[model samples]
Target: MTMRAVRLVPALIILLVALTCASLMIGSVSLSWIDLIKGFIRQDQTAALIIYDIRLPRTLLALSVGFVLGLSGAALQGLLRNPLADPALFGAPQAAALGAVLVLYTGTVEALSFALPVAALGGALLSVLLVLAVAGRVAGVTTLILAGLAVASLAAALTSIVINLSANPFAVTEIVFWLLGSFEDRSFRHVAMAAPFMVIGSLLLLRAGEPLRALTLGEETAESLGLSLVRERILIVLGVACALGGAVSVSGAIGFVGLVAPHLVRDAVKGDPKAVLLPAALVGAALTLSADMLARLVPAPTELKVGALTALMGVPFFLAIIARRRGAIAADAS
Candidate 1:
C-alpha cells in the first residue's frame, strides 16, 4: 500500500467511530458523552434503557448494512468491470423486499422473528439463481446485467401487486414505509439475524479482490492466469445475495450507498477495486449513520426516511458521474 492508502484507512476508521458515537447520541433524547459513558457503564438506568433498547440496534444495523452494501458494490464492480455496478442492480434488494412483503401480506411477519429475514434471504437466493440461470455460465457482463434487470422488474411488479391487493390499509402502509427503508424501531433480533449473513458474504467478496485484479487484464488474460471466471462469478453473486438480502430484510431498500461509496474511495485507492472495498465500506457506514442521524435530528413532524435522505445525497453524485463518463466517451470518439 502507498503512504496515502495507509493513512486513508486509519482516517476512515476514525471517522466511522466518531459517526457511530454520534449516531448513538443524536436521537430524540440527545445524549451527551457522559450520558453515553454512564449508560454503557450502567451508572444510569434510564440512559442505559434508551441507549440499549432503542439506539444500539439501530446504529449497528446502519453500520452493518452500509458495510455490506459498500463492500458488495465494490466487489460487483470488480467482477463486472463496471464502476456503476451495485448489488441492488441485480434485484437482490427488491427480491428480498418482496419476500418480506409476502410475509407481511400473509400476516406472518408478526408471528416469528426469523420468518421475515429467512424469507427475504430465500428470495435473494432465488433471484441470484435466476440471474445465473438466465445469464448462463459463459455469458458476458452485459448479459448478466440484462438478466438482473428483468428479475428486478418482475420483483417490483409482484410487490406492487401485493400492495394493491392488500385489504388492511395499515398493513399496506407498513409495507410501503418499509420499502422506503429505515433503521427506526429495529431491535437486537434484527442485528442478530442479519449480521452473521453479512459477515459470511463479506468474507466471500473479500476473496474476490486478488482475482478481480487479474480480471482487469481482460477475461482471456485472467483465464491465462488460471482464474476461473465461472467460479468467480458465482462467488460474487452468492455474496451479494446473502449480504444485500440480509440488509434489505431489516432496513428495507436503502439505495445509492453501494453506487456512491466506491467512488468516494476509488481515487484514494488509485482505482484499484480490491483496495476500494474496505474504505468504501467505511465511507458507506459513515454515510448511512450520518443520514440516519439527519433523519432523526431534522425538524419534522416525523423522522425522515433514511432511504430518501440517501437518495437526495446520492442522486446528484450519480448524475455527475454519468455526465463525466459521457464527456469521456465523446472525447474518446473525437
Candidate 2:
C-alpha cells in the first residue's frame, strides 16, 4: 500500500468518530457536554436513558446499515465494472420494499416481529435469482442490469398495487414511511435483528474482494487466473441482497449511501479497490449517521425522513456521475 492509502485510514477513523459524537450530541432535545459525559457514567438518569435507550441504538443501526450498504455497493460496482451499479439499481431495495409492503398491508408482520425482514430478504434473493436467470451468464453486465431493471419494475408495480388496494388507512402511511426510510423509534431489538445478517454479508463480500480485483482485467482474463466468474457473481449478488435487503427492511430505502460512500472512498484512496473497502464502510457509517442527525434536527419536531435527506443530497451526486460518464463516452467516441 502507498503512503497515501495508508493516510486514509486515520483520517477516516477520525471523521467517523467525530460524526458519531455529533450524532450523539445534537438532537431535538439538546444535551450539554456535561450531560453527555455524565450519561455515560450513569450519573444522569434522563441523559442515560436518552443516550442509551434512544440515540445509541439509532447510531449503531445507522453505522451498521451504512457499512452494509457501502460494502455491498462497492462489491456490486466491482463485480459489474460499472460505476452506476448498486444494490438499489439491481432491484434489491425495491424487492425488499415490496416484501415489507406485502407483510405490512396484510397485517402478517404485526404478529411476527421478524416477518418483515425475512420476507424482504426472500424478495431480494428472488429478484437476484430472476435477474441471473434472465442474464443467462454472469459475464454480461449489460444483460444483468437490464434484467434487474425488469425485476425492479415488476416489484414496483406490485408494491403500488398492494398500497392502493389496502383497506387499512394506516397501512398506506406505514408503507410510505418504510419506503421513505428513517431511524426514528428504532431500538436495540432492530439492532440485534440486523447485525448478524449484515456481518455475514460483509464477510462474504470481503472474501470476494481479491476476485473482484481480478475482474477489473476482464472476465476471461480473470477466469484465466482460475477465478470462477459465476461463483463470484452469485456470492456478490447474495451478499448485497442480504445486507441491503435487511437494511431496507429495517430502515426503509435509504438512498445514495451505497453509491456515494464507495465512490468517495475510491477517490480518497486513489482507486485501489482492495484498500477502499474499510474506508468506504467508515465513510458510509459517517454519512448515514450524520444524515440521520440532520433528518431529526432540520425540520424541528416534524423530522425529515432520513431517506429523503439522503436522496436530496445523493441525487445531485448521481447526476454528476451520469454527466461524467456521458462526457467520457463522448470523449471516447470523438
Can you give the TM-score per candidate against the true fold? 0.91, 0.92
lDDT of each: 0.83, 0.80
Candidate 1 lDDT at 162 equals 92
Q: What is residue 86's positional error in candidate 2, in angstroms?
A: 1.4
What's the C-alpha lDDT at position 284 in model 2?
A: 84
- The per-candidate count of clashes, in order, stands at 0, 0
lDDT (Cα, tens digit) per residue for candidate 1, span 1-334: 6677788989999998999898888877989999999999889998899899999999999998999888888987887677767766678788989998898787766723667777787788788778768876444545766788999999999999999988888877888888889999989988988887888888888888898898887778899999997788788778887887788888998888998999988899998867888888888888888889989999998779998998898889877876778765454344
Model 2 worst lDDT window (10 residues) = 136-145
In candidate 1, what residue range of length 10 has the lowest lDDT sum? 325-334
TM-score of 2: 0.92
For candidate 1, list the clashing residue pairs, or say none. none
lDDT of 2 by residue, 108-170 (tens): 667236777778888888887777677664435456557778999999899989999999888
- Give the Å shift of residue 158 in candidate 2: 0.9
Model 1 regions more than 4 Å off: 108-112, 128-150, 327-334
